[model samples]
Target: MVSKHVKRNYRIVRYVLYKETLLNTREHVWSFLGAFCGIGLLATCQGVWQDERLTVLLIGSFGASSVLVFGAIQSPYAQPRNLIGGHVLSAVIGVACQQLLGADTWYAAAFAVALAIIGMQYSKTVHPPGGATALIAVIGGPQIVAMGWWYVLMPVLVGALVLLVVALVFNNLTADRAYPTSGRFTRIIRRRQQGGRGE
Candidate 1:
């Protein structure tokens, strides 16, 4: 049996913590707007950089991935290194999986996405689009498989590099944000704790 006082206290606490603690700084505002601009750039590029070799939809989705990269929305999954390497690694892995398992249908696709997800988590570069990038390798069929590991070097790696360059420019132009915010700090701390004993 819950008392009215208890319920009221809960409500007041929630309001104070969740609602009253909101912050809306200028940096936050610019990061939000800058992400939209990055989205637009990627969308426009889809029309320009596309080839009919693959379907129209996949090309366009590169644009969406661009948003994830440049958005600077403070997601672990969207940082530049993750944005690039996660997808490239997953794409390469997916293609290899397709070849090994034979890309006939559901199982291979499932394997691709699951492996990609797990791989990203392990690597700590869990970009959301990496799942799609891996699936793209499977569904893209012979053309992708034919790239012979170079597929990642092309659209996956190259595309992410371009997106990162763009993100660097746009995300910095506003003067309120920066990225790759020192995963190295953790590394340094760990090394210090290990006391120079690593082989």
Candidate 2:
């Protein structure tokens, strides 16, 4: 004879707990390894070049990128094109905003992120972390500002490529997991399987 309120609360709690449970422990482990190696390699490269330390290596948005690229492998936002194009385009827009409006101003930071979102949407590479990438350009201090357009190539493009490589290797190690779960790679795989089956 549980009260109706008590039963409703129990159902809600059960639903939340179920959603929070991990479906596969091995997938989580692979995701952890991919992010670790990817970011580690980028950081190591930056550390090796003492002069570029300030402008190269890690960016805060990369951490968010790792979560999507590794943990959420099936998400369209985590796909290779989105990860690379989103960050590169956002960085370019961010640098432009900083140069035009000056990095110190609050408006510049806000507008950079807003414009980045619009650009990513238009480009069909709408990654959530690109907003942070855009904001970092506006507020990343003198070192980043000095790098200018170079920032778009180095930390944005290079770092993303490193992550993608690591994800491809690590995520595919498991039979059930496949990196770049959609797009051209998926099509190629589907075609191969169809050919194998003689369909």
Candidate 3:
């Protein structure tokens, strides 16, 4: 006759342990390498352009992007559509908010992030870093604000593409890891394989 409280405590402990499961050494190494290469490329670009008086290719949001694409590749938010679509949508919304309401107003910043989230949700691209991209557009210093719409094309869109390219390469390097856990890309890949087999 076990006590009910003891049984409940045991269940809770089991659940906690399950949730805290750790990845193997290989996963960690791959994640590290992927993130290092992804950001390293952007950083290199930034270094090369630092003295050019032009907008650099790096942004803070891409760091968060790396966490998802490299460390949590299986996350829906980390998939190709979310990674690219989310950042691009958020950048557009953020820039619009800044231009229409002016970054000086407090509500403008809030609106930028809020609307960006809505946009991502409706578009089915809910990458978390997108929120940061929106906020950066609002609160960013003169250099960012001055870039105006160009900001989206350079650091936001271009930077995301760079990271995406890296994720595509590194995430698929090993047999265990595959990018875009599921999506149109996966479907296309399956179709191609089926076609090859039939041929």
Candidate 4:
């Protein structure tokens, strides 16, 4: 006789393996397009706005965010609130850590990331890329250090918005892919469509 615990363990193993073994080409294509457009838009902005006083429109953390927001659209971390709030909050913490501890020390970077994680958790917007966003503020060189509070507005918030917009558009192009699995906006849109059909 199989014990219930053993059976449950076997089922879990099977589920994990099954998920890994499956291939979804359609899903991959959409993820690719979404990530490409999201990052490409930021890159284009950086190129267009380059000048004597360079505005940093692109940040490395956005690459990690692209993986979640586009490739793993259904994840809670990839949602609009998480994507935007996490980056913005983390950037604020990062800037504060740099200011308080001085960006030159390694501990400042560690402290920035650690505090950012706590901030995200407490705020209910735990996006993994936010850790990197915090670290970047500490070690991102003179340009970023110089930006100070402005970092939250430009590359962090602006870049996050761009990614969110692209994810919302491309992820909805296919019937199977929904950028946000559930949200008030989705409900409102559906209700309006139903009303329009009745009319």
Q: Candidate 2 has what TM-score? A: 0.88
Q: How many clashes in each structure? A: 0, 0, 0, 0
Q: Would you list the C-alpha lDDT of every candidate in the order shown?
A: 0.68, 0.86, 0.90, 0.89
CA deviation > 4 Å runs, candidate 2: 53-55, 187-199
lDDT of 1 at 127: 84
Arrange candidates, best lDDT first. Answer: 3, 4, 2, 1
The alpha-carbon root-mean-square deviation between model 3 and the true structure, to one decimal in Å, is 3.3
**Minimal lDDT window, size 10, model 3:** 48-57
lDDT of 4 by residue, 1-199 (tens): 5698899999999999997789899999999999999999999989999772346988999999999988888889999999999999999999999999999998999999999999999999999999999999889999999999989898899999999999888887666776687988666656665676699
TM-scores of all candidate predictions against the true structure: 0.66, 0.88, 0.86, 0.85
Candidate 3 lDDT over residue span 1-199, tens digit each: 5699899999899888986785599999999999999999999988888653354688899999999999999999999899999999999999999999998999989999999999999999999999999999989888889888988898999899999999988887666777879777656656665676699
- Alpha-carbon lDDT of model 2: 0.86
* Candidate 4 lowest-lDDT run of ten: 185-194
Tens-digit lDDT string for candidate 2 (46-130):
8887776344768999999999999998999999889999999999999999999998899999999999999999999999999
State how far residue 30 of model 4 sits from its true place (Å): 0.6
Supply the TM-score for candidate 3. Answer: 0.86
TM-score of 4: 0.85
